[model samples]
Target: MTQSLSPLKSFSPDSGQVKVWIRRLVWKMSIATFLLMAIGSATRVMNAGLACPDWPLCYGQFVPTQQMNLQVFLEWFHRLDAALIGMSAIALVGLSVWFRNVLPRWLPWASGFALFLIVFQGILGGLTVTELLRFDIVTAHLGTALFFFVTLLTIGACLSDFQGNNTANKLPWIGLTAASLIYLQSLLGGLVASQWALHQCFFRGDMCIVMNTHIIGVVPAALATLAAIVISWRTAALHPLIRTFANIALVLISSQILIGVATFKLHLQVAPLTVTHQAVGAALLGSLTLLTVFALRDRQSSGQYPASKLT
Candidate 1:
């Protein structure tokens, strides 16, 4: 039998209860999406992206019993996780519509857009295999996955208990800048991984530019992240969550930098380290997103965005 939500035993039909339920559901999906990305990264690092050699199936079957191995398992399970998350996204939209009166008007629309991103992500995922894991296709696949992850986080934050304040009007913008820079850096890193840039640059002395660009991109991203943390620390009476997020971002970025350096030094030969680098990067981005979205809500509730108000 299919399991219900964790809190279903005590679930109430009230609108407040529904809001909490949906918010918790979104956060759970967000965590699942995060793991899916990590699994995708592991698939790439393990050179298992094309293990099945088909879309939506392994060896043209639901499960390739004869071909099951580490590589096939990674690819197959990656698709499985993606499929489940896609289904959850559909449920999210359905629940938003089913409870439209009680839920925020934008929840349905935002969930729908997230579904759109996941659809696009699925297309990219297929292209990665059909097109022989071309660097651009692979990079776009990672980028779309990250975007979908961000969409979920945004939804969860909007439904969160985070309250707004007037103490820091500019923190939101700063957080956005940092988040955007980090996202671009991630795409660049994806390219570097997809093309095997580090290995090429280290051994064959080719593709140095791609690897170098990723290394150089870190400077701006790190500086922006640090700026957000410093500014948030100085903002008096900032929402406790805001400060917590900023601090988490700082720690994540620091860990990401160290992981990146280690991955590079090891020439990307260490699959676990390589995967950890990507996972840490995702976590860092998530932290920045939480900070930015909460800060944006603060600005909105404080009447900073008069024309475009959030519910």
Candidate 2:
């Protein structure tokens, strides 16, 4: 069937409309990246990290014909999601370039860096499988994924025009501290799981050192998160989104701790709980990123960074 096209409905949107759409796209991609981390976590928890036994393919074919088992499907879908994230990064970069006049000067460079991370993430995924999920490599893989997730969040925040810089805002450094603690704790937890330390806790007490350290590290992490929440609340009048993000971070961390307890009690054998733990970790990371965006400003042209300069 042929239909006549109407030029009346084809008018281009103004810069403001384009900006809104670009911001929305970046935000959606950021969230999708977060979910992708969760899926990747589930794949690993299900012992499917090597289900494909190859990079960018399954069973030496585009699709696994020998058997479409659960493990194979998880790994296949994980790779598929990674491909989608890569595509989104490309789109984000393209949008940044096309809308350079509206976006911050650093946005294109930042998006380009995110694309680099996607490529590096792919390499890490390949190594995780080829090297039989070595503890260090597996931990590195998780770290890289988290970093990429943070990068996307940062980009989305940069594109956002909703947050205003508040001269009254204080305690900005607290967010960075909390984020660092969360990242370190997550890395240690990943290392313990990848090395099978949690599984050996009952018998190989000596191998439980990393797990024990991770548990102990929770105290400081929780305190830092709490501090962030309190600071955000106090500064809410000046910066509302910061308070909202801090509250979300608190909730995620609380859920994460509960899940950690359950995962420990169950000896990390429960796949769902394990995945939930990792997913919460990603959410917490995203929240901390919001806090960072709330706290820091863009670098000034004079090379002097000021708290108010970001907005």
Candidate 3:
């Protein structure tokens, strides 16, 4: 987000300053969440989800230096990242509420909802261990993290300064649809990983349904994302910003497909490729989301959509 939300411009300079600070925190947390998801993926693939064997601690100690190894370190660092963000969420909410008089009224509520997701995500993370990495719980953990990531992006986009042209009509909705499909595809991908569906289908001829579902899922998500890029590129006078994000989404989804193919060919044995698959999926989703929010903001600010739609 390059600028403070337009409505907040009416407030005093101090309020603008406050918005800037909160926006920075949202961005920082967003980056951390992205890395946290990557680390979580690594933990799962490395069989480190259960390395701690306890909630919020490893072997009843904060550091667990004596037990620290690669698996333990992955799992431990993952939790540390989550815990830091959990606390930072509290501060985010506090700032939103404390500055509500001048900031957008919805900021505090949005922050609250994000905090709720993080709390639920924390619980799901615990269940992944106590439930012994049950496929369902693990899938939910990844899903919630993606959901939280989207929320942060939405908030950040709303606070951003945006510029758009007449060609933006319907692009926001298009990007949103693509983003939704991509999110579902990502969850499907998560399921495939959590259940070891690919490995099962390849070796034991089991869990083929899950693996196939993920394979079939690539169609809608890829088509929708490609549609956005094609429409943006073909449109005359579309904002460069939207074009840039669409291009990024295209690269990410394309890379994801290639990486998915490579990972399948390798049967998930290549840890780097497997991890990149998930990370790129997250990045693709983020690109689509930011594109949608920017379009929404652009239209709303330009009077095509009601202010309530975005600001």
Candidate 4:
């Protein structure tokens, strides 16, 4: 006769279920990171980065009572959201370690890297405030945040269950190239905003060289984005959801370009438009990232298909 099954063995979820939960958690974290980016862009546009004038606390407390204002609220809430993401990142690392036996081979390493990045991101945030928003530090801070967001996006894609027919599509490389170009442009954009170069160029027309650099950067970025969309559409094996995201990248980048033109034309006078442009830029980056990830996953499936299927 067989021995009775152990309680722990009997109650534990199957490998598939554990993977599903991990994927869901990663997706949630990605969404939180996306929203955090939007809030961050808004905070910068509002000129409220120093609303708290302190790190890990506002007005030397968990919350600021004496300095409560709209700017303070925006800054405080941004920090709060970041802290939440940090806690979630740590939790993710913990869960991945605990369930390393059940997770995919790559997830644990990625999770650990994410944890490190978030810790670094928190330190950068502090430096942005404490150092009085030096242009280089602020640019680095934004760069770190974007990197963190991209990490979560990758983790989410790895844990995703979306699958379609795997095909020999060469579009994945194109997507990767496009995404990288866009990311470079994003860093430049961040620099433009942080250094007040955009305002200087738009209003005073003094910093034309930097503005011209940004303008030239947009051409390659747009071309790459267009190629990614077109290539995605041509690749029949790509999942429908991935195609949808590629289409979204096209839309967002288009809107971003238009808004960017408007921002310059209007001399950065319209606050909402400028802020929306920044948010849309981030969204564009995210969509392209997802598209690239899904495409790569499909490519992998075309080879020796793993037991753990994408769909």
Backbone clashes in candidate 1 total: 0
Q: Of models 2 and 3, which has the larger TM-score?
A: 3
CA lDDT, every prediction? 0.89, 0.79, 0.89, 0.82
What lDDT tens digits, residue by residue, belong to model 3 across residues 143-162?
99999999998998787656
lDDT of 4 by residue, 49-138 (tens): 998888889989988878899899999999999898889888888888888888888888899999999899889899999899898888
Superposed on all Cα atoms, model 1 deviates from the true structure by an RMSD in Å of 5.7
Clashing pairs in 4: none
Report the number of backbone clashes for model 4.
0
Tell me the spans in candidate 2 whose CA falls farther than 4 Å from its real position: 1-14, 163-168, 297-311
Per-residue accuracy of model 2 over 171-235 as CA lDDT, tens digit each: 55777788889999999989888988887877777577888999999999889888878777776
**lDDT at 194 for candidate 3?**
93
* Alpha carbon deviation, residue 14, candidate 3 (Å): 2.1
Better candidate number, 3 or 4, judged by lDDT: 3
TM-score versus the correct structure, for each prediction: 0.92, 0.88, 0.92, 0.92
Question: Candidate 1 — which residues are off by over 4 angstroms?
Answer: 1-12, 302-311
> Over the full model, what C-alpha lDDT does candidate 4 score relative to the true structure?
0.82
